[model samples]
Target: MPGIRFSAQDLAATRFTCSRLREVVAGVQVLKDAGARAIHLPWVRQARAALAGVRYELLSQLVPMPARYLPDFLSPMPAATAPSLAAELAALTATAPAAVRAQLERLPRPLPALVADLRRDPAAGLGRLAGEIQAFWTAAVEPHWPRIEHLIDGEILYRARRMATGGPAALFDGLHPKVSWQDDRLTIAQRRRTADLVLEAGRGLVLVPSVFIWPGAAFEADDSRHQPGLVYPPRGVATLWEQGAAAPPQALAALLGRGRAQLLAELAAPASTSELAARTGQSAPNVAHHLAVLRAAGLLARHRTGRTVLYVRTAVAQALVEGGG
Candidate 1:
């Protein structure tokens, strides 16, 4: 029952951002925990194949299957809204040795030797930890990084619009069933502890949408934080690896054609041309052409975030995609 008691200052400071590091850590966690596999079965199987022989024993042990608590340092809150792997890894590498040891010492142990070594020499241990994560990313994450990034970006965009139109409730309510915002406070349900910790004067908050953190959510707030963060699974993880296009209502497809219908079917969660291309096995130019036509027909709404322009179904498009037509 841990919660963040937000002040006016905390609410003003809150913003949306996504992380690559979190997904990397979550991917490792999925591999370590057997029961957690069902949440992202497609990803777990694909990652298991990709991570073959990857030296993540230390990383996996640290985030054991049925985790009690994962050390905060692994999922560092990046200063940037959308941080690259290098930036996240650098943040991990720069952790203060004392902070690292304190978290490790608190772990339920007889610690693994590597973890013990890490607790003994945090600076050196940090280097090894970063090395393993970087290796894991290179092997399992890099190939799918674009699709993951786009999905998280689209989630932020959808939530941003929801907050703008419907205020905080619309934004927080969709995050996870266990996460809820009332008054100015945000409460996170924990599996074990029943006590809630309130932060009266938080610097800011980051909501990190993860492709791997499905079926659960995690949040943190402490004096050490410049910003508190909640990492929740993004909304459309089920479609991340899915290839079957949504069956557009027959009438809609008849009007829009099979190609554009397929494109429309896939945009339930906004995506860029490149992301759609990858998702549908189409060329980027082909996706772009279809998106242009969809926009012209008033069936899609385009919104730009950073350098990417995402397309989501307009109300009309939504009805059609749902077979209203």
Candidate 2:
């Protein structure tokens, strides 16, 4: 149980954003745990096969099962609200050896050979780790990044909307069962809490909503160099890998072609072209073509969340789906 005292300046600086690399990291956490398999079965089946050929011996050792404390270098606070995986990887590889050694020594050992190697020659080891992560990114995360990005962006927007009317209390309230905010202090229910970052100026709390780390939350803190962040599961975790919605109404399908109508029906939540393709069993080109046509017809609207574009149903499309007009 640790309380983060946030001064007025800190509150002003607090921002909500999503991380692509964080999702990749969290996916690893999910893949390693058996208990998470049932809810994430769709992804588990796919991710396991994709990851089988990747060289991640060191990467796996860095984030051990029952992950407690991970090296901050694994996911440094992204300078960009939406950093490309390459950028995040560069940051990881650039981690000061002193910092790498410090974090690794803290982990309970016997350290795996790869992890121990990182401490000995961090520059070389991290390069290999980054390469492993890149291979992993291609297999497990890149395929679903659009959907993951959409989900994270939507959650941030939802929290922003809540804060607008309900105030900060609402923004954090029920964010996670283990988190609470009051008296200009944000509290995280974690085993260890340090307040060094709280006293620093201009470094606000960074909020990151994640998908694979559902049922738990992670808090990160360090000196001014690293931004303090909290990574928690987003609200729509259950639907991330869900198949398409049920059949679109026949009347709507007649008005709009069957393919387009089906796409519209599955978009009660905003989604990317890739996401729609995965859920609906359509090709990327086909889904992209349909989304463009739908946007022109005013049945859908697009919003850019970081690097990904999300298409949500417009008012007209909503009425059409609900049998209104």
Candidate 3:
């Protein structure tokens, strides 16, 4: 996608900040909670763990030198034209280097331009954006292969294969997630187990790539049209960081509006749920329940400052209210 508006230098200054990084971490936690059921948390956990081994390399590839060069290269495209970009990406991938070619091919077939356009307009080209992103990353960034191939190949790719397929076959067995494609409306037993766990945990879901969890899972539309990897979350996570506001009546509205707003106003600083309830004249149980929900949703987080759990609103929560997401 076109880069966000920061200059190369400014972009370089932007390390994935606490706000963004925390969202990812929170999402991971929620996913783990959900995966406890037949959903298979181990698979997702393994995928994330594998990522740690190569995250530095992946980050380097994403945040390259010539600092702003990458973002500047893609800033002007209109969002609506993302599909066209996807088409461009698909064409480019036709000749990607062998090592990266396979990765590029696994992406949903879409235009790179279209994906880049998302930086300008997130919802513009919804259909093939993910594939286009995969293609673009492989083509634009894969050439500068860091010495992290062993991790990517041995860990990331290995875990991804396990998630896509169903077994931990020997590496030489050639059984891999990238090579597995289920087209018959089937469900993996492991995935179901994991999902059960997540629901029981009472949180949102985050899908990660692992030995038994497929990060590339896509779904067809009501009309039964085939959409590639990235089926859930309707819109990719990038949408939360893009221009327009998210679909409203958000996951945390109960704790962010005027009523809750009053409760927050009463607190000079962090306060316990019981304290908030007393000030707001709401029952402690109700207040506590809302607090837990907000914390799980990333709108708020709890920390132990003393003898009580202190609740604090997160920046993302404020941004969402301001229509910045």
lDDT tens digits by residue: candidate 2, 12-61: 78887677778777778888884754678788899888887787887888
lDDT of 1 by residue, 236-274 (tens): 877887765565667767888977998888887888887
Worst 10 residues of 3 by lDDT: 220-229
Best-to-worst TM-score order: 1, 2, 3
lDDT of the structure predicted as candidate 3: 0.33
Question: Which ranking of candidates, highest lDDT first?
Answer: 2, 1, 3
Give lDDT: candidate 1, residue 206: 81
Off by over 4 Å in 2: 194-199, 246-269, 272-325
Q: Residue 280 in candidate 3 has what lDDT?
A: 66
When 1 and 2 are scored with lDDT, the better candidate is 2
Per-residue lDDT, model 3, residue 264, is 36
The models' CA-based lDDT, in order, is 0.80, 0.81, 0.33
TM-score of candidate 1 to 2 decimals = 0.89
Task: State in Å the error of residue 196, model 2.
Answer: 9.9
Full-model lDDT, candidate 2: 0.81
